[model samples]
Target: MDADTADIATIGHRIRHFRTRTGLTLEQVSDGVGLSQSQLSMIENGKREPKLTVLQSIASAIGVDLATLLVAEPPDERTAYELELGRAQASPLYTALGLPVVRPTKGTPTPTLAALVGLHRELARQASKAIATPEEARRANTELREWMRARDNYLPDIEDLAEEHVKASGHVSGALTHREVSVMAKHLGFELVYVNDLPKSTRSITDLENGRIYLPPASIPGGHGLRSMALQALAHRVLGHERPESYAEFLRQRMQINYFAACCLMPRSAAVSFLQEAKKDRDLAVEDFRDAFGVTHETASLRLTNLITVHLGMRMHFLRVGEDGALYKGYENDGLPLPTDVTGAIEGQLVCKKWSARDAFTQTNRTTELYQYTDTPAGTYWCATQTGRGDDGGFTVTIGVPFADAKWFRGRETTARAVSTCPDPTCCRSADASLETEWADRAWPSARLHAHILSPLPTGAFPGVDDAELYSFLAEHSGPLGE
Candidate 1:
């Protein structure tokens, strides 16, 4: 209504945001500010008008300034667009879009101010959606992953940009070299520093302000790890990845950066040519590519999948699991069943112990390859996986193709057949009778590394990346990762 009412509303909103952000309850704020919890809640819900003294007391209790509590940020172009979009989407005109109609919150709705408050409430509701509920995150991730799989996980535009950058940096094919990275870093006005103690969960930290990129010293000794790390960090800048506004946008950006890094290391044209030659003998393998190119097994495995899916037009699936058989990442276009949660997500689900990925983890003195043929409700498929350890932890990477498509790979000879009825009781791996009979209550599966797998990541972007560690690092150094 009036300026005073608007300011009171803004103060209430800010106080609520701060309290929620700091994990403080209404009771705690009320107790500290000498107000009843009901009064505090009413103020927070914009149903009660609070005095200046009350606002100041609440601000002090929340560890923020009185002015900050009263003044709301003026929405920029993007925010204004989102607010308008939310308001419009809430209307009947855009009902087909299926976004929930933001109901007007109860209070007196003055003719003119009612519309503004309705829009404001709708904007608040939409802004909260950006944080993502668990279901929202799961659905968004599944949709994005499916979208990537539908396109065969190959982004031609991103590939072209990466290839152009590589050529411009003076590298002429094969795998990208360390020298190329150094040259590009210099061109981008960056100096690389190999630090031994750069946070356990972090691989590399880019200090754009200081014009220095920090790499774990371990990445430098061998394995072309240094180049991969440098290129990934540089990809954020070269690709102009924006600050992620939501979980889905964050996942898309991370995938783009990874795609860019992979393209730089294994050029699309060169990789397609190599695959064309290598597949002639039915000998296509990640190890073969790893040796042919100067990349690690993990990189080679991902690169091969990228090429085979896009270039060869074969639907495939890739899975990465730990020694404990937890699925770290998985993608499939082939109609083969993989373990998944109730929400139909493959990630974070425990792999069927009989599956090739888990089998690879148990092999003593395991060779560079482990292959298995699995039969599921959809059909039979053949998978080849390799187990490896790294700074973060140990993991196994498996690539599977439909039975019809397995003829193109060497692992087709393996008769190690298994049937998987995943997320089903009759499935040999998940059968309670089978497991209880074998271990008889003696086995332990490590209590399921909860790790907030089902919850929305606090940073609201980058599905698997540890944004908290990066934030802590940046806070310590007084620097920002991305604007």
Candidate 2:
């Protein structure tokens, strides 16, 4: 059957149902509709599709409306069972076994049909469980992203929690200070302890029994990350999180702690006020937001995604694409077309070479932020991007909104622009036709595997965190602060 029309088998069952319910036999309805009994029987058996006019006449002959025969659902439990049996027989799962197809008649038992469908469902479930580790991670990320998108990526409860913690720390200022972080830790009955040899697999570890949060003495540029790390460690206790049972739960806890830390670093009320004032003046910029919060540009950009659409009514997207144009992280409520896989994950997918996230890496002047307007299949979008280098390499932090909302942003007037028909091979992904014509027959380049490509997935409740190492570090440090 054509996809546009109802499945012929189900339709046939419905017609049979209405015909029998109206006390009409095949011969009687066939004669009334000007068709032979054999032809009508073929139609009833789903061996042939009747013309629309023929179906109409049959409906009229059977004392029913034409619409009654067009529904997709099987008319009865028996009909549903018959349909599933047929589908299973036609499936590769049964056929590949070289077993005879089971054909049932009116004499077939419903219990047998129920057992077959149940077996098929279990087989499919087991098949899906064979997904690889990377695929599982991608699925987890995709689910979490959709969850965030549904709530506009804003959790008022988490926001309120962070706000309460910040207030309890007596914070009224520019950036959340290290001292304030210690105070916040203490308020939760934990003290911050600086350490030279924290566990390599962990960022900050909370000694729940000892009531001490162990952190590294070193900090990121301009002293930004320590407070967030401290708050994240404290958050595990405050949020009452247990060991995650699955990758999805682990991802949820990670995002919650990250969001809590971000809100602590940049309290929502003050951040919203600052954004509103900037938007009012049409001077909203990521650099200024980063400076105001004294946080990294990436943190400010991500935090903006949590606050902007809900508070200022502006939809935007955030990206952390690497120097090689592969997207490392992405979030969007705006209609920017990102390259996504079947899992709906944008991470590890390459963006268009022309995207600001990729192009900003080529710019010489890293001192100033890069801005550009990109014409995508979704629409035009203007983005402000800042490039920075990390231990892994260089990447860009980009925040963009639709062209209509660009007027309220500081970089709206940038002359730098490009057109991207991405997710299409012809759009920056494929080589020029002439170039491809020349090279396709001649080249056989070996691809370099990315770091994550071949690495074995880390296992445990917390995927990458080494539990034995974490416990040892905590036990060693739990004795005394100086020790």
Clashes of 1: 0
Query: What is the per-residue lDDT of model 1 for residues 1-483, given as tens digits with 9 covering 90 to 100?
Result: 335333444556667778877899888989999999999988975579988888889989988887777664421332233334444655553574565655333342434344655665676676567666677767777888789888887788888988787887899866678778878877778877766567766778887777877887744567477787888888888888777877778777777888888888888888888888878877788777887778887788787768787688788888889877788788787876777777777667787877888888778856668889988778898999888887667889898899988888887888789888775665755446666698967766756554656666543344345766777775675554334
Task: Provide the lDDT at 171 for model 2.
Answer: 94
Runs of candidate 1 exceeding 4 Å displacement: 1-136, 195-212, 218-223, 391-393, 429-446, 460-483
lDDT of 2 by residue, 1-483 (tens): 355556877777788888988888998998899999998888887888998999999889988787878877788898888888788778886786688887777677989888887887786665444333677778888899989988889999999999998999999979989889889988889988878788899888878788888888855455677878888888898789998767678889999999999999999999999999999999998889989989998999999999999999989999998877888899999978888977678878888998988888788898788989999999999999888999889989899999999999887888999999888888887788899898999999987556673354576667678888998887777676664
Best by TM-score: 2
TM-score for model 1?
A: 0.66
- Total backbone collisions, model 2: 0
Q: How do the predictions measure up, each by TM-score?
A: 0.66, 0.72
Task: Enumerate residue pairs that collide in model 2.
Answer: none
Give the Å shift of residue 418 in candidate 1: 2.2
